[model samples]
Structure formats: C-alpha cells, structure tokens
Target chain A: MNNEKKKITMMFILIATLLFGLVPFILLTKRSGELQTGNMLGILVVIIIALLAAVIGVKRIKDLKQGQPVEDELSKKVLNVAGARSFYMSLYWLLAIMLLQPVIADILFDSEMLDAEQALGGGITGMAIIWFLNWLYYQKKGVN
Target chain B: MKNKIKELRARYNLTQEDLAKKTGVRRETIVFLEKGKYNPSLKLAHDVAKVLKTSIEELFLFD
Candidate 1:
C-alpha cells in the first residue's frame, strides 16, 4: 500500500484499538477494585499500545497533510536511537523499581504488593513513556 | 558536517519541498540537511547532490 493508504489504515486501527482495547480495559479496572496482577498488567499493556498508536497516528496525519512520506530515513534513524536509549533507560528504571518496590507499594497501593508482576507492569509503562518522550525529543532536536 | 544544500537548492530555484520531492524524502529532512543537523546516508547524499547539480564531496564539507 502507499504511505497515505497505510497511514489511513493505521489511523483506523488506532481508533479501533482505543475504543475496544483502552475503553474496555478502563471499565474492567474500575469494576475490579484493588486490581489483580493480571488486571493491572492488562491495563498497562493496553495503555502503552494506545499511547504508541496515538503518537504514530498523529505524526502520520501531519506528514500526510504536508505531503511527506509517513516513514523516512531520518525518522527511521531517530526511532532507532530513541528505542536504544529507552531500552537502556528501562533497565535502570526496572532495577530501581525493584529495589524500591516496598516503598512504592506502600505509597501507591497503600497495601502489600502481591508480587513482582505489578512492578513489572509499572516498569513496562514507564519504559513506554520514556520511549515516547525520547522519540519526541529526537524528532524535535534531530539525531546525529 | 556543513552542506551547501540551502545555497544550491536556491540556485536551482527549488524550495525545500521541491528538493524533498525530487529526493524522495520529507521536507523536514531537507531542512535538517540544510541546517547541518542531520547526516544523510550515502544514497540520500548522492540523491541530494544530484538534484542540486553538484558532487557529494562539493556539497558536503566534513570537519
């Protein structure tokens, strides 16, 4: 498919994912108070996917409007650098979370944390946020 | 790296969009190239040089 067509399809998929994946996950989380490990992980995963889709969808729209290709060499390079940086950052983030799990659980959950699953979910969410932020930064600042 | 993309583009009566279209890249890539903020791949450099009617070595000066 052409870039425009691919982008349009992606936009549709983004909308569908948000409507089905994110909304249902939110509803499920609300229905289940003091979320189970699986529930928390599910919600975080959906949120990360939604966030990434939203970013890419917005970028594609802008590119289409400007008559630019949805994916270009510069964008690819920036994405690679951002992904590498975020992956490295996530390792430290997870390690820090693991070390401070007790305090974090006390502060955030106000109860005993069940296991590493919740921390893992939180770590994954953090990683996604970091990746998104890094991507935006590199896009604006330009990669060497 | 510094490049004469902006100068050469203007000499060729090409806007950033025009150059981008000819080279098959986004206008932002052209802007970045002109600003010397991006290092293009060999293929992109060659493409841009061709569009600007110059050699890659003459277009890009590496310090």
Candidate 2:
C-alpha cells in the first residue's frame, strides 16, 4: 500500500504483537514464584523471536509502500459499521456481566466470586462472543 | 427505502460488479441496496444514480 498505509499496518502489527504476545508472556511469567534459569532462557528466546519478527514486519511494510491503496471509502464504511456494532455489543456484554456477576459465578463456576480475577475469564469470553456475533451480523448485512 | 439499481443495471446491460466499480462501492453494498436491506448515504446514492444515467429521485423511492 501507500507509505502512510504501510506505516499504519506496521504500527498495527507491532502493537498487536506486543499486546497479544508479549503482554501475555510477561503476565504468565509473573504468575510463577521465582524465575529459574530455564525461565530466563525462555524469556530471552521470546525476546529474540519478537525482535526478529519486528525486523521482518518492518521490511515487509517498506516493501508494501509501492502497492495499491489500502482501503476505499466503502471498505472503510463497512469496517466502521461492523466496529460500531461490535462496540455496542461489547458494551452491553460488560454491562450484563457487571449486573449478573454473582449469578454467573454461582451458576457456571460454582463459586462465590467477588473479585476481578474471577470475572476476568467470563469477561474475555463475553468479548469473544460479541466479536463472533458482530461477524455474523456483518455477514447477514452483506458486508464483504 | 427502495432503489432501481438492479433494474437500471439490467437495462444498461451492466453487471453488479461493473456498477459497483463505477460507483466506487463493493458488490455487497449494491446487493444490499437492491434488496432494500441497506440504505445508502446521499453521496453514494448520487454516485450510483450518476453511474446509472438517472437522477437520484428517479433511482430511489423513499417512504
């Protein structure tokens, strides 16, 4: 795509990789008591792999600058509509979870959950379901 | 809202893809418009009307 689009793509890839990959890795590591030598080695390997991925992503973006336009108006509108619907869906999901947290905990997990950790799993699952519902809505609305 | 996009397309011997390209929209959008499942913005309606060699008023019927 164009330079701006390529830059945007690269930025998106970098942020996504950090958010979905590195953040989880760090969080999982933090769950353990103390870092063993093996854990240190694993962290180092992850860092090296992340760096290599960043380098390749940057190179790919640079190469993409000479390609076609990133998105036309209609495609952007489709995304806007789908994203807005998903936003509403997620908002409702959060509200429902907040309202029914105790009931959900009792019914599903059989626990008297009163903390964020207990609700976190359900919240994530709700978000995933919202995303799927948004996809289905888009499909029904004939958004390509 | 209802539109005469399919009728006009057939009259002009233009496929939905051809009309979509001419109007700078996806075929899905055209399909939705023709089926009355989606309403177009004023600009898109004008663009499609222009590509179909018709006026917006003649192309779309609003209730």
Candidate 3:
C-alpha cells in the first residue's frame, strides 16, 4: 500500500487498540476504586500499541529506504514558519495567563492555580493545533 | 515570482510527474513550483534547471 493508505491503516489500528485498552482500564478502575494490576497492564498495553503505531506511521510516511530526504526546501520553510508562529502564539497566551495568575488565585482562593503539568498540557495542545494547521496549509499550498 | 516550467515542460514533452520523479520530489512540489506559489532553494533550482536542460535564469523569472 501507499503512504496514505498505510497512514490510515495505522491510525485505525491505533484507535482500536486505545479503545480496547480503555474499556479494560475503566472496568478495573470502577470495580476496585484503587490501583490494580489489571489496570496497569491495560495502560501499559495501550502505550505499547500507541508507540508501535507512531513508529510505523512515521517510517511509512518518510519512505526512507536509504536515508533519502523526505522534505524539500519549500516544506522545510513552511514547517519553520509554522513552528515559529505556534511558539509565539502559545508563549503570548502563557504570558497572559502568568500575568493574571495572582488575580486568578485571589478570585479562586487557591494559591496553586496552574501547576507545571497543566502548563505542559497547554503546550501540548498548542503543538497539536500547530501540527493540524500546518498540515492544512501545506495541503492547500501544494495543490496544482 | 513567475516560472516558465509549464511551457518548458510542454516543449520537452514531460509531465509534472515525470519532472517530479527526475528531481526526486513529490508531484505536489512541482505543482507548487509551477504555479509560482513556492520559492525553491538554490540546490532545488539547480536540479530542476538541469532536468529541463535550461538555466535557472531562463526557467524562473524573478520580479
């Protein structure tokens, strides 16, 4: 199969594996209300499948048989612009949040408003948005 | 940026896919280049010019 087909297949497999793992995890968590071996095993299996899907998807899309370059100059430029724009956008939002953190804490009466994990989650969301927007932009830009 | 790729490819009886294969890039890249929507690197310009048997100056008209 071609790259597109391979990607679709990999996504389907990954989604199926995630759903499969999620059901077991939910059931075990509901049954015990505490950490259990089954729950851990289910999460572990999901992670492994997700990793496998990611690796296979990347390999197929790259089509790197002998270290050939997958991206041309235009693609590289587009990616750079996308990454820079995403970083700036995310940074501006984070700074705004930081500036308002004291006020937010006062309003909520909680000093620990946003933790490092929540900040990381915001960054991840920003990255995901950038990835999708970049894909859309390039798909349109590269059309005949 | 404007390019004479479409005209030159017609002259040489080469399709977009053919040129893309020659230059080791995807067909979408050639489409973008032909439409003057994407600026190529010097190396890519050289490679494309070589494939078309013409110079970059003649193939790509910069304004």
Give me the candidate number with maximum lDDT: 1
The best candidate in terms of TM-score:
1
- Candidate 3 lDDT, A66-126, residue by residue in tens: 3333565655676677666667777776776677756754554345475554444444544
Ranking by TM-score: 1, 3, 2
lDDT winner, 1 or 2:
1
Query: TM-score of each candidate?
Result: 0.86, 0.61, 0.62
Cα lDDT tens digits for candidate 2, B1-60: 787889999999998778877876666677788998777888988999999999999999
Which candidate would rank higher by DockQ, 2 or 3?
3
| 10 residues in a row with least lDDT, candidate 3 chain A | A60-69
Question: In candidate 3, what are the lDDT values of residues B1-63, reduced to their tens digit?
Answer: 899999999999999878887898767688899989888878888999999999999999978
Candidate 3 positional error at A85, Å: 1.6
Q: What overall lDDT goes with each candidate model? A: 0.83, 0.67, 0.68
Question: Model 3 TM-score?
Answer: 0.62
Between prediction 1 and prediction 2, which has the larger TM-score? 1
Q: What does fnat come to for each candidate?
A: 0.71, 0.12, 0.17
Candidate 2 falls in which docking quality class?
A: incorrect
Candidate closer to the true structure by DockQ (higher is better), 1 or 2: 1
